[model samples]
Target: MEFAFNEEQLMIQDSAARFLAQVSDSQAVRTAMARPEGYDPALWQRIGEELYWPALMIPERFGGLGLGFVELAILLEQSGRHLLCAPLFATTCLATPALLLASNPAVQDQWLDAIASGATATLAFAGTPGLEADNVQAVAEPTGNGYRLNGQYLQVIDGAQAQLLIVAARSPGSQGDTGISLFAVPADSPGITRHTLPTLDQTRRLARIELNDVIAGSAQLLTDAGQAWPLLRDVLLIAAIGLAAEQTGGAQQTLDLTLAYIGERHQFGRAIASFQAIKHRCADLMQQLECARSAAWYAACVAQERLDPTGDVGVASELLEAAATAQIHASEAFFTCAAESIQLHGGVGFTWEYDPHLYFKRARASEQLLGSPALHRERLAAQLLGETL
Candidate 1:
């Protein structure tokens, strides 16, 4: 489908770019990442209150701007470009989608407002590295009052700092997607332990969470017992699209950084960018960035359509394929551009004083965050072959 940003989208994009350029510069990013929280609280508050970015896609009834996925993608792209150290991705892309997809309005009414008003949240769904049904190993046993959860979640985005934790678990003895459930547990609840994990990408923080007989009352249940896989699956697809947009932005920035370096660096009394080899390399990076950006934009459009009930629902079926395609392309593009950026910058790229290494680390980390390119390809293949995932 033909896709282009409208006037409003362009305005949002420009505004995000300008704001991030000022508040999320290289020095600001370095400062934020050095902190235990991984972001400045004041900056996060400004993002929610002044920018209203966290509420961009939430429904107006929920005290949000009631925008769509495209707008969110635009904002995320700018965030990725600036390496914004915030929980926006965890709050908006991961947890918010799960809350929005849940069938329970009570759950939505309880949490959506909090999220819109700046309460951070994250989804702790993967007990393992892969994004598959079998990865949900957390077990939830029914109690007279609510439920008792016992399990561990690894690599939860912003898990250490989020105010709310949307956890995915399954009934005892249940396997695969059946008997899956989601619970909205307070991060400070009893018997819950969170530890921030050391990561190569210091720009983003991930945590390991332990839930030991944690209580989740009935009101905290986000989905019907044993019937949350579909909702979780859709939420993951939307998140993949959002992440793909970020990767595309990172790729563009890496390419731009490389170009600037090559143009200014002198080699044999001439700019390195004037060389045929460097020109070809830059051209290839541009090609990859453009392709990745195109895939992300298309996926964003498809996602927006799927979310709109009055839109052509037929396009909704393509969401899975679009998400996988976008994820695959964007992941590869970002990694390639980041690696190339390092190489193009000579020795400084490998130094801590330079910015290329930071982007490189983020590229490698994000490629495995949601799912690897190989995993996405496998899912895409299974989807095309009509095989169960």
Candidate 2:
């Protein structure tokens, strides 16, 4: 199927590109990364209040612009291109989607307006590092009309500053997917503690959250035990698509920066871009970017198309496969292009003063943000084998 951005979408993309280019310069990003919050509050307010970005995808009923995921993806792509040090990804790509997929109207009504009004939220999942079923370590026990959660959840994106946290934890007395549930815990809860983690990609902040008998009221519980699988899967699939779009944009920016650098940096009395090897590397990057863009954009279109109240089962499966494909291709393409960009720029590229290494760090970290290529390949294999392993 043909894939191209519409006029409105193109306008949105251009505006984001311009805005990020102005506010998210390499130095600005570095300065922000050095901060405890890892982002500028003033810049974030401009994005939320002026640009109305956080509300871009929420429905109109929730005081949002009523746009689709495509719009959200475009903004994220621009942010990624600039290596922006903001909590936009956690709020838009992760927390919002988790709420939407939960299939609970009350919860949606409660949070969507606040998110649209510039309140920040983040997702807390990934109990451990592995992709296996056994990786889930957090457990929640039923308490007085609610659940008391106890576990150590690592590396929650923007956990330190977020006002709300959309958490995924397993309930007592079950194994595998059945006992898992979703919760919406206030960040300042009594028993929840957070510690910022040192990371390779300083632009993105990650925090380790410890829940010591943390109380989750009934209102906080989004999905009951065993009923969260489908919703969680849907949220993940959408997140993958958004992340893939980001990766594609980051890859494209890296390629563009390299192309410009090669044309300006002379060797043997001629621009280094004149060399056949450099030309070949540029061509490979171009191909990877095109492929990644197509994968990301196509998946975005499919995700936007499936936003109706009644979704086709076949179409939903297609969306899942497309998301996995986008994640795999875009993640790898960005990493490859970043590596090549560093090589094209010679020794200076590896230094902290240079900008290429920042993109490189982001690329490496993005590879496993939601899931790794190997994990996505397993999903692809299951799709082909027609079995869930």
Candidate 3:
């Protein structure tokens, strides 16, 4: 596989970096985080209409840019570096993949077009941090004309403000992957309630959503009953690859921030950056960041191949391995680098005015957003042992 970015990909990366550096600076992030919606609506509109980032991975038939996952990864890395405060991750990475992988063509046309036109959406699958099949606890019962859904979803990214919600539920008494179903429902549908949760990372919003006898028509179902697990599983693998890229970017940014601070900080009539111990620590951080970046980029490449229509069927297993590896390595690298950045910055690192604390919170929060590093390691081990996940 080609590991280097082509000219077009390089241009996308450069444009994303420059745009985010100007719009999502430290003060802008703080201001957006202080809002009830957790982001600036005007800025989000500009991102969708002007930059068209949400349409990067959607097909051209759906009124999108018809780009691939690699482009999305590039944009995500830049967003993560700037600590961007928007629903782009939830909408593009989580919801868009689910829609693309669903079996219903009509549902795909409707939602994909909306998303490409700046409509934000998110997936509500797991009630907890893990994305295992059993994590879906919502119950869906078939009525005369549709399905009645009743359950609660926790830690849904951008759930409170999303215009649409792609929900996962299962038939009564269903366990594991059996009887699973996915529904694309409007966020304001009757009998639905959503509220933002207090979290360590304010830049990215998470919410608790409840469905009290919510109704979904047959047209709203993304897949037939008991057939959504396979689709959701693949969608989650894609989401994992995207998130790994973001974590890699955050790790790189933390290293860069620490290096800049150390260079300016002097003690005993000399800069602390000249010290051997400091140099060694920075070197270790760089090594970790490089490894994480490699893993993330490799996963992104595998994801693009997996999504290709003409690609080999055997690429599925490779995609799984790549995603798990990237998730494990990137999560650890980000958290470790964020912690080390705090310690290296001296007394002001933990202060409210310092940027290290924000990165630290984002690192800890994102580490558990999909699943912990330990969880990914376990999954990878199982897959390597010839066990079905």
How close is every model to the real structure, measured as TM-score?
0.98, 0.96, 0.98
Clashing residue pairs, backbone N/CA/C < 3 A, model 3: none
Cand. 1 Cα-lDDT:
0.92
Q: Return model 3's CA RMSD, one decimal.
A: 1.1
Per-residue lDDT over 128-191 for candidate 1, one digit per residue giving the tens place of the 0 to 100 score? 8778889998999999998899999999999999999999999999998899999998899999
- Which prediction has more favorable TM-score, 1 or 2? 1
On residues 8-30, what C-alpha lDDT tens digit does candidate 2 reach at each position? 99999899999889999988998
Each candidate's number of clashing pairs is 0, 1, 0
TM-score of 2: 0.96
The predicted structure with the larger lDDT, 2 or 3, is 3
Candidate lDDT (C-alpha), each = 0.92, 0.85, 0.92
Q: In terms of TM-score, how similar is model 1 to the real structure?
A: 0.98
lDDT of 3 at 262: 95
| Residue 242, candidate 3: C-alpha displacement in angstroms | 0.7
- Candidate 1 at residue 169, lDDT? 95
Worst 10 residues of 3 by lDDT: 305-314
